[model samples]
Target: MTLSPLTSPLLEGVTHGFFTRAGGASTGIYEGLNCGTGSSDQREVVAMNRARVADIMGVEALAGVHQVHSATAIVVEDVAARPRADALVTDRPGVALTILTADCQPVLFADRAAGVIGAAHAGWKGALDGVLEATLDAMEGLGADRGRVRAVIGPSISQRAYEVGQEFLDRFLDAESDNGRFFANGVDGKYQFDLTGFGLARLRAAGVAEAEWTGHCTYTDAERFYSYRRATHRGEADYGRLIAAIRL
Candidate 1:
């Protein structure tokens, strides 16, 4: 199968993509390009899928981290392990930085003037924990001005479909009352939190000049994307992850 990479016109001229879960070698539940090594997908299929992504990104090697949903970010310097971090920033050219997402947001960043690029996996927990802000800070540490950075969020579960319990709302509101703006009344007493909107808010609050989401919903779209919520809703064994990448 071939690859499908969703891109943005605002980020034109920069090497970046929001890849879909289409055209891969895996079978069954992981039927597409499941690039997540942390997933239960077969190792061989995952390797091939990542290699394909590396080739498409025009990088001999793609660098990624173990994504612990923390506020931590790493300055890429040929690290040996995929460190326990949620974000990565690099000024070095040819290093394709990638992030895996299954309903969570895979965000890419670029400061064209500074020749710096960043990749992050931002779930609700990570966003609440300030992972996006951490990423921007790490990029600025490498000479990137936050105001000059452009951040784009890839496919993630949209608010209308992201039904959460009362506890989730409590966490966000307790952390910051302003975060209550990101939620809407769900079917019952539940609330639907806007993950992408929260992500954009974090980026903008961190002083990023431009931040946008591709306006894609992973849970609602089955043919082109993978969703952890969808898998659980259907009682499926496992779910694959989608990969988004960018390189300088």
Candidate 2:
């Protein structure tokens, strides 16, 4: 099956995509294009799905990480065993950096002139801990100029669907009181946090030449997205993961 992936003009020159859960070998909760090796969907099926992604990206393999929601970013010289990090940056030709996400942000970065690209899995915890900035730092280390980088955030849980308690608000406020701008009051004392907006702000703050969000809300689009929050709310056994990738 042909896969349908979203792209941003900001990354026009880079070979990258924010792939939706569309065409693949999984069923049930992991209905389409479930590329997550960590998921319980049959291991062979996961491998085949990833291989399909690699083929689409025109790369022999896609490089990725274990993604533990930390701020760690690693530079890849070659595709080997997956590292224990949340982001990856590389200038190597023919290697595609990929990241998996459900409701979290999948951010892709590129510096065309430098032949450097990066992919990050930025959940709220990782974003708060500076994973986005760490990704930029790693890209710069690989010879990508921060001022020439373009970063695009893929589908994520939008503000209207991201309800959080006072504690969540407090965490953001504690980080920076200005973070309050990214939240809107929900019912009672709950607040809605804008994951994509927060990610864009961080990317721009880090001196990226251009940054954009694809404006897709994973939680609200069940047919095209695999949303962790949606599955948990519906009491499903497991959820699929969406992949975003970039090649230098």
Candidate 3:
């Protein structure tokens, strides 16, 4: 099967992709394009899948981090052992920065004129902890201007599917009461959190020139995407991971 990677006009001229789970070697619960080495999927199969993604991106290797879901963003100068971080920024020409997500945001960042690019795995913890802003700050250190940076968040769980409790709502509200706007009432004491909306607001607040979500809900779309939540709801053992990448 051929790889089908989604692109954004805001990142024109940058070679980047929000890859779907369309074409890969894994089988069973980890059905298409499972690129996460951390997954319980066969390691060699996961490697082959990542290689396929690198081929489609036209890079020798796709760089990734251990993804601890923190705010740390590291600058990638070469492909050594993957680091323990949630995001990566690179000014190097052929290295592709990649991030894996099942339902969390896989955000790609680029400033074409400055030749800087980044990829971040932003779950709510990472986002609220400032992973998005940290990515831009790291890119700026590599000569990218925040005012010229363009960011696009790839497939993630949407507000309607992201039901949370009052404790979850309190976490964001404690940071800033204005965050209350990002939540809507859910059944019982639960609330629906707008993760994509929160991501965009953070990007805009950080002074990114352009930012937008792909508007695809991973939890709701089982065909083209993988959803950890959906997998758990179905009582599955494990779930596949989707990759998003960007290269200068």
Candidate 4:
């Protein structure tokens, strides 16, 4: 089956895709195009699925690392046998940089004039750990002017459906008092936190020229997206992760 990739014309003339689970050789709970190496899905199927993505992006190989949800960034001049980081920035053409996520944010960045681009896996942990800023820093390190960098966040859990406990709110407040604005009170003392908004704020704080979210909610949209929280609520054994890639 042909892969389904969501794109943004705003980042036009560049090679990038936010892939969905509509095509591939997977079955069971991990239906289609489950590219996550961390998943319990068959490794051979995962590899095949990934190879398809590489072919579509016109790259020999896609460079995706072991995402530990850290703020760390690695600069890739060429595709490596094994990459060991969360975020990747490169000026290397034809080397597709990929990031994996289920409900977390998958952010793609490009500074076209400098021919530099980046892909990051920014979950709550990574965002608070400064992954967004770290991505911008890595891109600038590769001669990309931060002011020329354009970032777009792919599908993630949205605020309306992301209810959290007071403990979660306490953690953010502990990090920064101003973080309170990202949360709105829910039932009782529960709060609804905006993951995409928080990610956007991080990008803006890092001096990104323009930043935007695709505004799709992974948890709420069952047909088009995968969601860890939703899967857990449904009592599923495991959930498939989606992939987003960008190349220069």
Candidate 1 per-residue lDDT, tens place, 1-248, comes to 68989998757778989888777888898888899898898898899999899889887678989888787899988734688899999999888888889899999999999999899999999888988988988999999999999999999999998999999999998999999999999886999989999999888888988999999999999888999999999999889989999988
Clashing pairs in 2: none
Worst 10 residues of 1 by lDDT: 75-84
lDDT winner:
3
Q: What is the lDDT of residue 157 in candidate 2?
A: 97
How does each model score on lDDT? 0.90, 0.92, 0.93, 0.89
**TM-scores for all candidates?**
0.97, 0.98, 0.98, 0.96
Model 1 has how many clashing residue pairs? Answer: 0
The CA-based lDDT of model 2 is what?
0.92
How well is each residue in 44-148 modelled by candidate 2, as lDDT tens digits? 999999999999999888899998999999998659668899999998888899999999999999899998999999999999999999999999898889899
Please tell me which model should have the higher lDDT, number 1 or number 3: 3
Tell me the tens digit of each residue's lDDT in model 4 across 1-248. Answer: 78989988657878999998878778888888899888999999999989999999998788888888888999985576446678999898888999999999999999999999999999999999898899889888889998988999999999998999999999999999999999998998899999999999989988888999998899998777889999999999998889999987
Task: List runs of model 1 lying over 4 Å from the truth.
Answer: none
- TM match of model 1 to true structure: 0.97
lDDT of 4 at 232: 96
Q: Is candidate 1 or candidate 2 better by TM-score?
A: 2
Q: Ten residues in a row with the worst lDDT in model 3?
A: 75-84
